[model samples]
Target chain A: MTYINELDTPCVIIDLNKLNNNIKDMQRFASKNKVTLRPMIKTHKMPQIANMQIKNGAKGITCAKISEAEVMAKAGIKDIFIAYEIVTEDKIKRLLNLSKKVKLSVAVDSKYGVDMLNKYFKKANNNIDVLIEINTGLNRCGLNNLDEIYSLAEHIMNSSNVYIKGIFTHAGNVYGAKDKNEVNDIGKYEGNFIVKIKEYLETKGIKVDTVSTGSTPTAKISGKIKGVNEIRPGNYVFYDAIQHSLGVIDIGSCSLSVLSTVISKPTEKRAVIDAGSKSLGLDKGAHGISKVKGYGIIKKFSDITIERLSEEHGILSLKNSKIKIGDKVEIVPNHACTVVNLFDYAYLTDGEKILDIFRIEARGMVK
Target chain B: MTYINELDTPCVIIDLNKLNNNIKDMQRFASKNKVTLRPMIKTHKMPQIANMQIKNGAKGITCAKISEAEVMAKAGIKDIFIAYEIVTEDKIKRLLNLSKKVKLSVAVDSKYGVDMLNKYFKKANNNIDVLIEINTGLNRCGLNNLDEIYSLAEHIMNSSNVYIKGIFTHAGNVYGAKDKNEVNDIGKYEGNFIVKIKEYLETKGIKVDTVSTGSTPTAKISGKIKGVNEIRPGNYVFYDAIQHSLGVIDIGSCSLSVLSTVISKPTEKRAVIDAGSKSLGLDKGAHGISKVKGYGIIKKFSDITIERLSEEHGILSLKNSKIKIGDKVEIVPNHACTVVNLFDYAYLTDGEKILDIFRIEARGMVK
Candidate 1:
C-alpha cells in the first residue's frame, strides 16, 4: 500500500471502515425486516466488495447488463440477476452459457425479450428463472397493466425452458421526492403495486415466490410494506450528495470521494483543481431532492463552490479565499456510481492508513 | 476489419471518410491563414489519431495534462504543448522527462507552477519552454492582469533553467456565443488580446515568439485577426450536437456516434435503447448556443427525443416512433470528447464498409 499523499491526484478514495459499516448496517436492516438484500454491483463493480457483501449476508447480486453478469460469474459469483431486458440473439446465447455456470435469473418486460431467452434456453436444454418487471410509477420501463403481467407469467409457465420466479419493480421515482414523507409514500406505492401484481398472478394459478422493489431513497421504508421480499439498493454502499440531500444517508456516511489538488489560484475569487468532469462525472445533484447546490461538496473548505468544469479543470469560486495553490482537498460527488466507473482503480483506506487497492474490474461492461 | 452489423451494441462508430475530411478541412484553413495548427488530443485521446493529425500537416499537438503529453511522447510525437498548468513535483518530473524526448512547452499562470518546474529543471540540468496563460474571457484558469503576466515572465526569465516561450490563451467562452457574429467577435478579441500581451512583453525586451489562441467555434475567424501565430482547435475533428448547434460544423460532418439497439418498447411513446449516460455521457449540450434540445440527436429518427438516461438505459420519447425492438440506430452525443473517453475502443467505418478500429489509448490519464 501507499500513503494518501503519495497517491496520484484526481484519484478515487474509498474509506474501508465506512464501507464495511455501510454493508453491515444494510444487512442488519434487511435481516431485522425479514427481507433478502440483493445489492446491485453497478455501484462498486469490484468483485472483492461484492464478495464482502455476500459474506456479510447479501442473498445475491443485481446487475444491469449481461456483460456485468459475465464478469461476476467469471469471478465465481454463483447467484446473479440481470435487472434488464435481453433481446438480442448474441446476448441471449451468452446469457444461456452463463446460466450453466450460475443460478441465473433475468427481468423481462416484453414478449420479444422472453421469446429470445426461451429460444436460446430451449436449444441449450436448460431452464432459467424469469421475473416480470412491473411499472410502479417510473415510466421508463416495465409492464404497467396487471393483465399483461398475468399473460406474461402464463407464457413463461407454458415455455419449456422459462419459469416464473416472481415480480420486481424499481422505485426510481423516489429520487425525485421532495422530502422524506413523499419518499415514504412512493415506497408504500411501490411495495403495494408489486404485491398487487404478484397476487393477481397467483389468482391465475401461478405461484409467485418473490416480490422485489427498492431504490436507495425507498429501501428502508419500503421493507415495512410487507410484500417486498428482496430489496436491491445500490447507492447505499457509498452514499453521495444526492443521497445526502434526499436524507437517505448523512453526509458523514459518504465513503467515496475524489482527491484533488488545487493547482492554480487564478484570482482571489477562483481556484482551479485538477479534478473535472472526467473524474467527477457531470452530474448536477438530484432531480427533486433539496437543492444541494454546486457539482459537489468540498470536504474541507465549505465556503468554496465548484462553479464550473471543463474536461480536466474544475473551477472553484472562493469566498474569503481560504485555499492556496498545491493544497489538496477531497470532494464528495453528487453520484458515486458514475464516479466509480470513471476510475481504473480506487484507494482503499481506513481513515489514516491505506489498506489496499480496489480494481474496478467490471467497468465499461455496458453492453 | 469487421462489418458494422457484426460489432457489439452500445459501441462507438467513427466514419473514416468524415474524419479525414474534417482533418483536411482544419489543416487547409490553418494553412490558408498562415497559422500553425496544434489540435488538442483531448478530443480523441488516441495515439493513432494524433499521428494522423501530424501526418496531415499539423505543426504539433496540444494536450490538457502532463500524462497526455507523456502518452503522445511515447508514441514518438516530437512537438507537444500541454495547454494546462503542471504544479506537483511528481507531474513536473514527468514533464521534464517528457521534455527530454520531445520539444515540450507547458502553460503556467502561477508562481507556484513555474517555481516547481524551475526547481525540477534546475536539478536535472535542463531548460523547458514556459508559456504564460492569459484569461481572454473564459473566467477559468488564467491570469487576468498584465502586471501579473509581466511579473511571472520576469520570474521565469530570472530562473536558471526556465525560459519564456510565448503567451497563450483559450477562448473557451466562445462556446457560449449566441450567433456567428459573437463567435467572430470573441475570436478577434482572443487574437488581439494575446498580441497586446506579446507587444507589452516585447517592450520589456522579453521577445515573446508565440501568441497562440483558438477554440473550435473561433478557429475559423480567429486567424485573420493578425499576430496570432498558432491555433489550437479540438472538437472540430468529430463535431457533436453542441458544435452543430453553435454552427461550427454541419450535422453531416459529425463522424462519431454511438450505435445502439432498441431493446424494449414499453409504451407507444417510450422506447428503451442500450446506450445510456455510461456510453453517451451526461452532457446537456453546449454552453449558450441555440438549444438543440435533448440528450442527443438520433441520426435517423429526427422526431425522437432522448428524454433521459440511467446507468445503462436510454429512454426515448418518440413521436409516432417507427422504431421497434432490435432496430439499430446511431446517436450523436451532445459532447464528443467525454463520449470518446467512455469507450475503450471505437469502430472505424466508411459509409457502407468497415475500415478499422481505433483504441482510445490515453483515456483516464487524468493525472
Candidate 2:
C-alpha cells in the first residue's frame, strides 16, 4: 500500500506517457534542427529519467552542480555538461575528479572563472570542454558583450587543462514573452546572436564547438539555426502551468502533478486543500494568470485560483468551478522545477497505471 | 569540512543563546498570562529542540502535520497538538491510530472536517481531542462563524470516543503588519476575538480547557486574554529575517542562518551560491526590505541580493558592492520555518562549536 496507497500525499506523480512523449518530441526537434540535444537533468533530477531521455536520443545530460554530474557519471551518463560556473577550492577538486569518470564540460563567463578552474585541474586533466555563457537577455547570470566572447573563448583555450568548446545562453527572457510570436522572436534573436558570436569566435581561430540556447518557451517554438550545434533545454521534460500559459505546451502535456486532498469547504467559493507553500511554492504570479494560477489550478476543479496559501493550508475561492470535499485533486504547480526540489522521491505513472517510484538522487546537494 | 566548517554558508545553524532567550521569553509571557505554552514543533521539527522547550517549561509540542507530531512523539514528547485539518481515509487512520504512541490533538474548522475526524475517532479505543480552529483574520483555513463552531464542537463532544479540546487560531494576520504598532494592534484584536469566543463557549456550557491564540509578532505583544488558556507559537523558536523586519526581534536575535559557498562569479555584478530553493527556499518578499530583497539576504554580503534563483543556483548580484569567488557568505533567509523543511539534516551550533546533528525526520512527508 505504501508503494501505491501508503505513500505520502503532496508527493509528485509523473505521467510516464506524457514524459515519454516529451522525450521523443525533444528528440524529434533536435533531429529536425540538426543539433545535439543535451537535456539538462536538473529539471527531473532522476537518473532513470536521464536514462529515458538518453534512450530517446539525447546526446548527453546537462547538470547544474558537480554533485549532480557525479551522480550522472555514476549512473553511466558519461557525456555530461555542467551548465554552471564552477569555482571555489573544494568544488573544483570535485569537478576535476568528476572529469576522470565522465566527459565533463563546465560553463565559464569571466577570466576569473577560468583562472580558478585552470589552477585546480591543469595538473592531472589533459582536456575538458568549457562553454562561455553569454547574457543574450537575462541579466541574472551571464556575460553581456559581443566584444568579450573571443577573448573569453581564447582565455579558456589558453588554459593548459581546459578546451574552449562552445558558448551557451539561457533565453530566460522568453519567459517574459507576451505570446508565442514573442517567444519565436526571442528564439530567432538568441539563435542569431549565438551564430554571430560562433562566427566571430571562429574568425578569431577559437574552436566554438557547441553554440547552444534554451529556456522552456524558446525551446518549444525554436525552429533551426545554421551554426548552433547544440540545445540545452530543461523544463520541457515536464511542462507546468507556466509553460501552458506561455503557449509553450498544453496542460495535458504537463507530466508532474501534486495529489492533494480537499481539507475544508468553509465557503461556497473558497475551499481549502492540504497543499500549501510547502508543496506548491511561492513562485506564483511570475508569468500570468491562466498559465500560473493562485497556488495551483485544481486538476479536478476548474479555473480556480487557489487564492491564498499559508504554510499548511491552501484556500481555494473561484468562479466557474465545481469541486467537492474529500476529492483528491491533482495540482500543476506554477513552477514545476522548484516544487521537485522539495521532495526526495516521486511516483511516476503512465496515467492509467503507476510506473515506478524513483528517488530524486541529486535533489539537494548545495556543497 | 562540510560537517565542521568555521564558515557558515551551507546549512541552517541555530543560535543557542537566542533560542534559550526566546524560550524564556515565551515561557515568561505564557506564565504571566496564565496560558499554557505549546511551542509549535513545525518550526524546528527537531526532537532535541522540542525537548529543550519542554525542559524550559513548555506544556507540549504543537505540530502542523501528524507526521511531524509522530517524529516528536518518538522523541518522548507527550502532549501533541496537530494544528491542521486532517482529511482523506489514509489520514483518518493516522489520526485514529496515532494515540498508540502519544496524546494527539487536532485543529478543525469545517463541519465536514469535524465529521470525518469524529467518524474515524468517535468509536475508537483511544480518546482524541478536537480543537475548533477559528478564522481570526488569516482567512486561510478556519471556521468563519462563531455559531458554526458550537455546532461542530457539540457534535464532536457528544460523539462516542472523541473529546472537544477548546479552540485555536493563528494571528497570521500579523504578517501584514506595517510596524510594531500595527502588530500590537493586531495582537489586541486577536486577544479580543479569542476572549469573546472563549466566554461565549463557556456560557454555552462547553468545556473550553484550551483557548489558544498565536503567531510570533502577535504573541510578542499579546499580553493577556481573559479566557484564552494557551498560546502556540512555532516560528518564535528560530526567529527569521521576516520577524526581524516586523520589529518583533533584531537580526542579531535571529537563531537561524544558512552557511553557503560563493560557487560562481560568472559576471562582475552577479555571483551564484550552491544553495537555492533546495536548501534556502525561494520564499522571497515575505515581510519588508528583508522580505522583498530575495529568498535570503547575505549576512556578510549585504550589498548583494540573491536576486534570482534556479533550482540549484542562488544568483547573488552585487547591488552596489563586489563579491569575489571562494567567499563563504551567511544568509538570513526570508522565512526560517520553510528553510527547516528544505534539508534532510541540520547542524545545531553554539557559534563555532557543533553541539549536535539532527535529522529532519518528517521532512518531505506532505501527508
Candidate 3:
C-alpha cells in the first residue's frame, strides 16, 4: 500500500483477487470435463503463482521454452510439459539436461526436429516423452497429414531415447474467429480431429494416452472430447482483451493491468501516455474494453482508442472524458502474455491496495 | 561464426558493412554541414559500435534513457546526452551517478521537469547540463511556447545542479510528412526555431550553446539549416524498411534482418516460418515492396506476407514462392528501433560471413 503511487508509472500490476478467480474458473471447467489440467506456467513465470495453479487442482505445469521450464523446475515444479519443439542441437542439449532434472515432455512436429531430439536423448543416455504436434486447423507448426504424424510417431517410438506418449494441437486459429459460436464450433472441430487421430493411432497398435487440444479462446468452450486426457492452455492464466473479445473470459476475470500516467495533451482529441510499445506492446489491437488491449485500455475510458504507439510513448485519444496531463490511468493490456515480458517485476494488488510483488523471473529468456 | 546457425530462427542480423557505411554516410553529412554529430547510441547499444561511430567522426553519443548512458559510460564513452526526460526519482539518482562518471547532459521540456533537474543537482551535490527541448512540431514531448521555454531555462540557470546548455528539438513530425520538400521545410523550420530560441535566451542573459535537431527523415535535407550546431539521429545508424519507405536512405543501407526458416508447409498458398512478433515485430507492417499487408518484408520474395504471428510462429502466405519447410529466408523488419530491443545481442555480418558479435548492452533500462 505504501508504494502504491510511489512506484514509477508504466509498471505492471496484477490483481491477486482476480487472478485467484480466474484460476478457479479454469480448475472448475477442467474438473467438469473430467480432464487433468496442466496449467501453462508461461503466463506468470513466478514460482508462487505457478504453485497457486497446482494448489487450485492442476495436475502439472506447461511451458513454451526450455529456459522457462528450467525456471519452473528449479522453482520445484517437477511435472512440466514444454509445449514447443526443441529444434537445434544446443536447445536439445538444454532439453536433455532438463529431462534429467524433471518429468519432461516435448512437442515435435517435424522429422528433422525429432531426429535431433532422438540424437540428444541417445547422447544424454536418457529419454523424453514426445507429443506429436498436429496442424488440425492452426496452420502454424504441426503435421500436415495422418501419414506424416504416424511416421513421426513411429520414428519416435523406435528411437532409443524417445517415447511416444501423446498427440497435441493448439487451436490458435480460433483467435481470429467471428463470435462465440464460431469459436465453439472451431474448438469442437479441433476436439473431434484430436479424438479421431487418437483412434487412428490406436488402430495401428500405438497406445495413445494424452490427446491434448486447447487455446485460451477455445479451451473454455471445449468440453470433454472422447479421448482427450490432458488440457494445456497457458493464456487462460491471465486472459486479456483478445481472450475476452472471443468470449473466452469476461473482462472482470482479467487480472493484469499497466499503471500509467498521462504525460502529454498533444491536442483536444489526442493525449499521449507514458506507456507505449515498451509497455502496452504492438500485439493485436482490440475493439474496446478488453480484458486487455493491444497496448491497453484506459481503464474506464473505452472511447479512447490507442491508435498508434512508439517505443517509449503511448498515444491515447479520448472521445468523451477530459483527462489532463498528470492524471494517472490504469490500463488492461491486449495480450497479457506479451505485456508481462517487458517488466522485471509486477506489483500484486487487490484492486484497492498493493499486496505483494512477483518477479518476472522468466523475462528475456528468448533462447 | 561457429554458432551462426546454432542460434535459433528469426533472430536479428546486423550487416557490419552496411552498418559502417550508414554510420559513415551520416558522419560525412554532418562534416559537410559543419556540425557535431553526436549519434544516438540507443539505436544499437554496442560500446564497440559506439566507438566505431566516434572513429568515423562522431563528436559524442546520445542516449534515450539514463541506463543507455550508463552502459556507454561503462564502455568508456565519456561525453553523452540523455535525450529523454529523466522523470522518476530512481532515474535522477542514476543521473547523479552518471554525471560523476561521465560528462552527462539531459533534456528538459517543462518547468516542473526542469525544477526536478535543478533540485536533483542541488541535493545530489552534482552539476549537469540540460538542453531545453522545444516543440518544433513533434508534440510528443517538449515545451510548446517561448515563454514556457524561457521560464524553464531561467529555472535551470539558477538551480544548484542545473546548467542551461542550449535548445534542441526533434522534427519527428517530419516523418509524417509526404515528401522530401516537407522534410526540407521541417528541417528549416526547426533550424530557425532553435536559432530564435537561442537568441531569445541570449537576450535574457542566459547562454544557449547547443542548438541541435535531427530525425532521419529530416536529416536527409537538413544541410540547409545554418543555425544548427549538431544533429542526433538514431535510426540512420541502421536504416530500416520504414526509413526506405520515407526516402531517407536506399534499401541497400538497411543493416539488420531476421534470419528465419520455413517451419510449416501445410498448403501451397501458406508456409509458416519459425518467427513471429517475438522475432520480426508487429510494429509497422511492410514497406519498399508493393504489398503493405502486415509485419515485415520477406526479402527477395516480395509477394509473401507474414500475415499473422503468435509468440514464436510467423504465419506467412504467398501464392508464388515455393518455400520448403527447411528453406531459409530473411525479413527486413518495419521498424529497427523496436526490433533491436527484443534480443540480447546481434551477429554483425557482411552478407556472406560473420564480422563481429555485438551485444545490446542497454537492452531493457526502463527505469
Indicate which candidate wins on lDDT: 1
- Give the C-alpha miss distance for residue B84 in model 2, angstroms: 0.8
Candidate 2 chain A TM-score vs. reference chain A:
0.94
Question: For residues B147-242, could you state the per-residue lDDT of candidate 3 as single tens digits?
Answer: 777777777767777888888888777766666677678888877887888888889888888988888777645544777889988888787777
Report residue B197 deviation for candidate 1 (angstroms).
1.1
By DockQ, the best candidate is 1
Tens digits of per-residue lDDT, candidate 1, B36-100, equal: 99999999999998998999999899999888888888898999999988888888888888988
Model 1 residue B114 CA deviation in Å? 0.8
Which parts of model 2 are misplaced by more than 4 Å?
A1-8, A125-127, A220-223, A285-291, A320-322, B2-9, B264-268, B285-291, B317-320, B353-355
Which pairs of residues have clashing backbones in candidate 2? A1-A6, B8-B259, B9-B259, B9-B260, B10-B259, B10-B260
- Model with the higher TM-score, candidate 1 or 3: 1
DockQ, computed on Cα atoms, for candidate 1: 0.69
Per-residue CA lDDT of model 1 for A58-86, tens digit only, reads 99999998998999988888899999988
> What DockQ, between 0 and 1, does each candidate earn?
0.69, 0.56, 0.32
Pairs of residues clashing in candidate 3: A241-A291, A241-A292, A292-A333, A292-A334, A293-A333, A293-A334
Winner on lDDT between 1 and 3 is 1
lDDT of 3 by residue, A1-367 (tens): 4555666777898988888988888889899889888877667778888888998998888887678888888888889888877666766888888887888898887777777778878876778898888886777777748887788778877778788889888877777787889988988888889888889888888988888877777675554677777777877777777877777777878889888876556457777677777777776632111233435566788788876676777777667778866677888788788788777799998786888999988876655
